[model samples]
Target chain A: MDLIKVGMADLAVCKAPQKLITTGLGSCVGVCLYDLEKKVGGLAHIMLPDSTQAKSVQNVAKYADTGIVATIEKLMALGVDRSRILAKIAGGAQMFNFAGTSNIMRIGERNVEAVKKQLEQLKIKLVAEDTGGNFGRTIIFDPQNGQLHIRTINQGEKTI
Target chain B: MEFENLNNLQKDALKEIGNIGAGNAATSLSTLLNKRINMAVPNIFILPFSQVVELMGGAEKPVAGGYLQVSGIAPMSMLFVLPEDSLKLFLNILIGKPMSEKIQLDEMDISVLKEITNILAGSYLTALNGFTNIEFNPSVPALAFDMAGAILGNVLQLYGEVSDYALVIESIFMEEEKEVKGHFFLLPEPGTLEIMLQKLGVVF
Candidate 1:
């Protein structure tokens, strides 16, 4: 099976028999959208929660708000119906924590919230999610089965 | 200030800064561990955020990272990383304990690593301040045992908002006898580089 790699602050769309993979997500979120009927999947590795915080709006895939929309659009362009698309998200981990840190340090939680809000706004049902912990995650989405495999150090692999 | 527009003189200046910082860090590390740590000449690169992890071997490579957020004068972040396989060796040398490969790190082990990171970061920052006469205060060091990409992502996020590329100064160090190796990364926040260059009297 072909594995399409998604880099940080990037997105990719692929059909069945191909898998979408994003690695080393820490405080960053991986938003995976899969269309059951069309057997298409799109993954976006977003770094921040909002694009409003960005100095340049050139890379939409770097923020949860814009990255989710861009991924949905890419899936729709591949003949996937908006109604048939469902979301499975992962990552957005704190990675490390300190006492009395500010809200900005909680970017992981914020990214998860922002991505969820965006998906809800699009009226897309969020099927499953493995998020909000103090660990990094590497996720692989298999469009053929609509399965998301999350891998972490020390912790065993889990399919969501 | 665009990194690509940096002239050779500017690049050399940055390299020298990295060298001096790494040299001090090495000295402190050697004293802490009671071992002679040899550091290679620091290499500086201006790369897209996506490619920063490639320097650590790959995005998915598991490693132990020490992260510190620096503020004042020139805000930035610093990272100290060691490969998973070398962690046991590092711990054994630091604490004089027989740490096996399969043994998990306990709270004490993590604390030891954090203290070492703190000392090294302090030494690095002190050297930079001495050179440029600028002040930099670092936060308490944080430790993470995760993939290189994940650890680096935290530091890169500060710059992701303003620029697609990051300026990275990497220093590789090894204890030849023990075969232990680690990498140190210094990343200045957006526009901080300009301030640093100006402090050193390097225009443009």
Candidate 2:
């Protein structure tokens, strides 16, 4: 099958194709997970830091907490073992503004922290990460090559 | 100066206000997408916070939501509402994937959506301020929950009924032969409508 295009607030999993990708992550985070033996890969492009404030079950997969868990569930559905999955994450930039009280709301930093905490709780080893900066990022995950590429506004493309 | 209170006549008069606002927004979108955008007449409404969910007509409710909430020491604040699907399309267009066959809303899409909201809201506010000679600044865009209930609960708790008025404007975005609807919300102070009518010089 051709490479699938994943949209905002979405998640996707692939088995044989071995490549799952997403783009344009500002305050959002793109989490790439791969199980080499099963050749299963999953990617989640999450926006919000947590789903605790979500109003419905539908938004669970839209927030970081639910988005990551949904991705893992899809990968496991593909027969990938939870223990064998390794994670790589990118994007969480503070794009604009510095108001004091709401500044601490910091969705970008909170998203990164939420991803880390969620992955650790799931016992998913985070092998690589590229996060936190003043710029936006465009990321691609190639499961076939086990490579994740990140391109920033000012920075050139580099493998993570 | 005290802001004038909003009434039915003033509320109806400002229906065309967002037409100009969206036109300005479309200009920005054209530059960013490198495609001309044909924006349509804007849809305007005034309701309470609880009406936001019912207003977004569809069975497939948006999985994600974003907000640019600003609270001024002057006791005035603004909330910008963003849906997830339109956000995906906006980002996909920017990344050279403007015509993706299957666009699914995801986390990555929401971040970009927030940025886009920041741009649109900034432009909208600037246009409104410039046109009305009002002085206001937007706070940073924050993550709004998908659940309408919780989101409104938080707003009501902080703002206290907000004078029972909310303004929602809808416009169609036509770019590269594709048409999409974009919505903007304004919950101005009680007297904002009256001030706007006076500025427009409505004889009535």
Candidate 3:
């Protein structure tokens, strides 16, 4: 079994019998998209909520919104029906304090919102989601079995 | 208010602080990496955020920034930035894994960096806490671009009131069989430092 590790602000895509895992989702969001028919799944771990903040959109595919859209599109290009795609989301913890009184520095919340909005825009239902808290999460997805494993500090592994 | 004069004071403070922080960070890394980790005293600097490229000293591009941010009710708040390659090496040593071709985001790296920040930041805050008695918790570290512009830009935007003085400490990490370099930037307002020193009972 080959284990592909996804880091913060990174993403990975795999077909059946392949596995994608992302760890340490603190204030970051991880989106897992799977297609039962094609047995293909893609996972993206995005640090920031939006790519517009960056100088260029070259790494738009690395941001939460654009990354999920691109990953879904890739699955579509591979002949998987968009409607048949199931999504699982995790991470987006508010791990710090903002200088301002407002919660504008809530990048984790923003990442979760952005991913959900994009998924909704694409008409994909977030079948399962683990998001927004004061803790970090580690997630694993098996494209072949469509199993999602999530782990957190002081919290053992559990499937969502 | 000469830049050199101010920078010299900032440099001394940065070295002293870096020695304490890096010493603690090294101890933590030794436990996590399961090896004896030695960190060289930091090379101090006070410069604008845009100076990263030059500071690289013709080393390499696409430098990675491993950031550990801590905020508290205290009057002082700051961040610590670790180099990407150094972090990569540190993670490799910590996990006993061979160096990968690229430092792409991976689970091992994320967890390691996050934990590293927790350890390093905790140590730093504890050290500060002793003098100030202010409690602080660090935010999970996320990877940042090593480019001076982006980091400094974020610094400006993040702490608008605190600027013009960034104490950067450049150091090397040495284990029995390995050697790597690292950086620690202490950005504090002059007033903040003055207050902290006063609190520490260090007059001058």
Candidate 4:
């Protein structure tokens, strides 16, 4: 099976037997969308929750709001039915407790909320999620099964 | 002060700032650990966010990281990263723990590392303040043992909303005759560069 790597602020789409991987997801959220019938999948590593906070409009995959929309549009362009698309999300960890001391520090939770809201607005069902913790995660998504395998430092590995 | 358009003189000025800051940090670390620490010349780079992890030997490299947010006129982020193996060696030296290649860090170990990061970051900021005469204080350092890419992604996220490129000052340090090694990263917020330059009396 071929593995496609997604970097920070990046996104990728692939077909069955091709897995999507993103590493070291601290406060960032990884959104994975898959169509069971088409066996097609897309993954986005979104760094921030909103694009409006940015100075310039660029790299739609870097922000949760734009990244999710872009990923869905990419999936639809590949002929996957928007109605059949389901999402499995992972990451969005706090990574540090000091970040919880203030609202601006809670980027992980904010990213998760923004991602979910974007999915809801797009009418995509969020089938599974493993998010909101004080640890970093590396995630791999198998397009064939739509299974997200999450790996953390002390917690070992879990698939959902 | 866009990092993307920095002239050679500005880049050199940043490198010098990194040099002085890392030098002070190394001294503080040496004093804390009571061992001589040698640091390489600091390197300043303007890189796309995607390539930042490659500086630490890839996204998946197991690393222990300490992150701090500096709040002041020129806000920035500071990161101290040590490879897992190097961390074991460092801990062994710091607390007289028996050495093991793949030892899992306990709570006490994490605390010690965080304290070390705090002191080092404090000294680094102090030196920069001395040079530029600016007041910047570091927040409580947060520790995470994870993939290098992940820890750095958290630091870079603050800048991701503003620009695609990041100004990174990187320095590598090693304990003399020991296997302990670490990387220090200084990521100043955008427009802060101009502030720093102006304070240093550099026009750009």
Strongest candidate by DockQ: 1
Q: Output the TM-score of candidate 4.
A: 0.96
Off by over 4 Å in 4: none
**Model 2 misplacement above 4 A:** A99-105, B1-15, B20-204
What would the per-residue lDDT of candidate 3 be over residues A1-160, giving only the tens digit for each residue? 8788764445678887879986555556779999977899988866556666655564444577778878877787778888899999887765544345334356668778888888888888788887876555667898887888887544456888
Interface RMSD of each: 1.2, 11.6, 11.2, 1.8
TM-score of each: 0.97, 0.54, 0.52, 0.96
lDDT of 1 by residue, B1-204 (tens): 887678889999999999999999999988877789999999989998899999998989988998888989799899999987778888887787686656577899899989988998999999999989888999998898888888888778878888888999999888857578889999988788999999889997
What lDDT would candidate 4 get against the real structure? 0.89
Docking quality category of candidate 1 according to DockQ thresholds:
medium
CAPRI class of candidate 3: incorrect
Model 2 lDDT per residue over B1-204, tens place:
112244556545676567776777778778877878787676666554335435554212432344565433222334444345555566667764455554454566556666766777677667766677665667666554233332332332232212323455555566666644454555545445556556667534
lDDT of 4 by residue, B88-138 (tens): 888888898888756687899989989988988998999999989999978
Q: What is the lDDT of residue A160 in candidate 2?
A: 81
lDDT of 1 at A144: 89
Better of 2 and 4 by TM-score: 4
Number of the predicted model whose TM-score against the real structure is largest: 1
lDDT of 1 at B146: 83
Q: DockQ of candidate 1? A: 0.77
Q: List the residue pairs that clash in candidate 4.
A: A24-B150
Residue range A12-103, candidate 4, lDDT tens digits: 99998889999888889999999989999999999999898777877999988899889989999999998999999998887766744765
Tell me the spans in candidate 3 whose CA falls farther than 4 Å from its real position: A97-104, B1-39, B43-204
| Alpha-carbon lDDT, every model | 0.89, 0.61, 0.61, 0.89
